[model samples]
Target: MPNLLDIELLRTFLTITETGSFTRAAEEVHRTQSAVSMQMKKLEEMIGRPLFERGARSVTLTPDGFRLLDYAQRIVSLSEEAAAVFSEPELQGQVTLGVPDDYADRLLPRVLQAFARSHPHVELVVRCEGSSSLGERIEKGELDLAIVTKCDVGEGEVIRREALNFVGAREHATHLADPLPLAAGPQTCSWRRSAQHALESVGRKYRVAYTSSSAAPLISAVLAGLAITILPESAVRPEMRVLTERDGYPALPPCDIGFLRARHARSAIHDALAHHIVTRIGNLSPAVLADAAE
Candidate 1:
């Protein structure tokens, strides 16, 4: 018989990838660092290949480890699903999820209505904030899961991609302003970074004309023609106008939306909610997107 891969070990392995270090992984798994090391060594011996490329303070997947990633995720997810079917435990617990304010108005209602209908017993707590702040909260285990805008220095499961656009109010000439006036979230925003880079690439001048941590206020400034701003395609209101290459604005990078799970929290409710989110929010299918827009 072929040797069976231990689900617990794979679970630990996934934790390490999310947390970025053995020390943090051990903390998440409630194991000592040495025990985590031994588990990896044993797994290596079983598989006849090394899984991690060790850094001074972090661990990245080796090529072999990357090969195992999809398999591990599927195996673990299926195992949990199978267990839930047999055990049939009522998913009754409080789960805290974070959502970036930039998307809250447009995306939250659909996600909430679907989840609440199916799992009424589960108490859901939501924190609305900037993606950068939410990402930090997720890493520190303050949030059970968080939706974030993908950035280079962070890691998450990218679930959706949409074009990030240069947007101004319709019938406004804000995009053509000299040292273009821009409205955006605070300095930490990824969209702000993309806007700056795109402008710099084409030798365009711009200044931060307004800054707000909340999307509502930022949109208000744009609609008032105070400044132009960046927004995901799905988030752009009908009243807003998109700036295109024909308008002399350089194209912006595509925005990636993804989720991060808390390294330490594993529960049926969490998995169920994650599944709901992926099914409902992942692709933005035509029907789902249309309904969500309503």
Candidate 2:
């Protein structure tokens, strides 16, 4: 008999590769650096091959690591799919889920597809709104579950923490404008505030060249080279370029993603969906995994 690869280990492996830093991946997965290293050692032992060429500051994948990456990604995704498929087969109810526009495209599909496949009888009522609005909705007992941003010190259970960065079109010099042209959201948006604060801290003059409540349009504005905007590092697209300190863009605070559940009631369906959201989104995202494989 052969050793079957562990999905959990594979997930951790993916995290290490995605971050390229054991310490960083450990923090991402809420584990100690030593623990993460041990896990990787275990994975390497199972494969009978070294996975990483460990350097002082970062780690690069070995050829075997690259080969395992493809398998790990598929195995982890399929494992999630399998879990979702077999989860709460008897539960039948409705769950109203609220998500902000930014994460709808990046994070929703897995939840939607898995929930739909796993619990077909349960209706997942999804609402697209800003995090502030979503938080208000949860408090008002209008939403059963919500993925919202946590800007303040402490409030909700944070599921994901992502790097916030200044992003512009790949070929654009919009960031170099005299009063740097910025494409951002309304005053209430956390990301917008982060960008503003980062710029203000450095006394960088900037003007709002474009404003949109939705992330999709703001992304469009950046792609068109109209302006630069703040985005999650993982969410940056191929057409976009991250503006670093060399480009005079100050680093913004990391974005915190929190999950909310309505106080109205707690049913089996609600708990199941909530668990699903936390598990899927709490870990390194599929986007990071794809980038690692690339």
Candidate 3:
């Protein structure tokens, strides 16, 4: 029989790639540097190719490593899914989840889908609002859980920090307008605040030409060349163009996205849901995994 690839080795490989250093990866995996080194050696032997371009201070993925990464992630996800199917009992209860308007179309589906698969009996009630409003709801004990974005220091477990970008339509020149047109959400939105502050800091003139609380209208505004909006890097679509420093858009600070649990928690069901959410979403990316783990 051929040598089988190990899931642990794959995880370590991903950690190393994400952290950009073997030392950090070792810390993440709770292993010594030498042990991590040996695991990579064995993984390379199993694949019969060099996975990393080892350097004095850092290591980078070789083409073979890059190719294998996708497969490894899929395999690990499937393995975890299979284990979870039998290991976790069918749970029953209601969970009220709050998310920002921007992430409803992107992050919510994955979280709800994973919960549905493992805890079919649990009822999920979802509410969409701005991050600040969502945090308030969590504090008021109206929501069981929330994923919120914060401008400065965020509360709760930060899963990732995504850079903000000025996005415009792919073929549109709306960003070229004098006193650059901006499409923004409500005044309370952190992203909007960050965008305005960044422009002010750079002495750039901008006006809120379009305003919408929902993503569709904002996207439409950008597509029609009416205005450009600030969005997290992950939210940038192929139909959109990301305007950088060269495009005269000032660099905006990264947004801290985190999971906030209600202060007055209730049952085991909520705990299970929280654990499931953290694990499943954490696995989505290396950066998220590292942060969620911490």
Candidate 4:
């Protein structure tokens, strides 16, 4: 039999091609730059061609590189599809789930509790992080499923898209001078962008009064009157008030929260969990569903 090409090396090659830098690809794959280079070298030797043109400051794919990339992507995608179809067993084992911090606190607990009550034998492992981080973990196969906000779809199944709304403390003064102070999350957060766009569309200037990756601090800042924040209605607690809608602030376009799974994951439990989330949380806003249909 001929020497078989390594799937891992192909994956590394694809990552390098997509990111356009070996250093960034190494960071993404959690390998050293030298290790990534070695993988590329091994792949080139196997294929009997140099795939990339190495320059002093930059690297670009050669003509051969483009051809190999097409094949590599197809191979990886087919491999994942095959794995998903053939490897998945009946639901009876653990399922690792990732959820955004706000969702975990406000909406997920009930869904999880219900799932636990029904499927006591299946262990559920939950990871809480920002939506972007959650999506990254799911893509890397570190997580089975994730609930995220407005992630670039790229090429994957989108399980659901929930609507997000602007929220604020009911007691805070509705009126503010130019450049409204906005409480926000890290730059990667989808809601942060929505808040900024909402303000800008209405000809309102804004400044970031506070920034945190975690949900607790962001909520605290809102409660303390430091600044207003935008969140999904499902994430809003009973105590929080709708300052924007009440004060006649123009409504922001609804944020789309989505659930995603690895294309290659082999677990019936993942399917079941995804079905549960989409049916339950996805249906929370009839208005959103109607709008999407329209």
Would you estimate the TM-scores of all the predictions? Answer: 0.65, 0.71, 0.76, 0.60
Name the 10 consecutive residues with the lowest summed lDDT in model 1: 285-294
Which of the numbered candidates is closest to the native, going by highest lDDT?
2
Pairwise lDDT winner, candidates 2 and 4? 2
After superposition on all CA atoms, what RMSD does each candidate show versus the true structure? Answer: 12.1, 7.9, 5.1, 16.0
Candidate 3, backbone clash total: 0
Prediction-by-prediction clash tally: 0, 0, 0, 0
Candidate 4 lDDT tens digits, 1-294: 666778899999877766667888888899988889889899999989897777666677777887787677667654654564455543478888888787788768756865664556788999988777777787788988877775533434444455566666766752353567777887766678777777778787788888998888888877776677877777787767865655756676665667788776656677767755664455321111110000
Model 1, 221-256: lDDT tens digits are 899988999999879999999999998899988988
Looking at model 3, which ten-residue stretch has the lowest summed lDDT? 285-294
lDDT of each: 0.80, 0.80, 0.79, 0.70
Q: Which pairs in model 4 have colliding backbones?
A: none
Q: Model 1 clash pairs?
A: none
- Candidate 2 lDDT over 1-294, as tens digits, reads 879998889989887766756767788899987888789899999999998776544457778888897788778866876776666357887889989878888888877876677678888889998888888888899998888877732467887889989999988778788898889889877788888888999999999888887888899989988889988865788998899999888888888888888897598898778867876677533322222211
Can you tell me which runs of candidate 2 are displaced by over 4 Å?
Answer: 6-44, 47-88, 152-154, 284-294
Model 2 per-residue lDDT at 263: 90
> Best candidate per TM-score, number?
3
Minimum summed lDDT over a 10-residue window in model 4 is located at 285-294
Over 213-287, each residue of candidate 3 has an lDDT whose tens digit, in order, gives 777788889988899998887678899999999998888887678888987765877886786666655433442
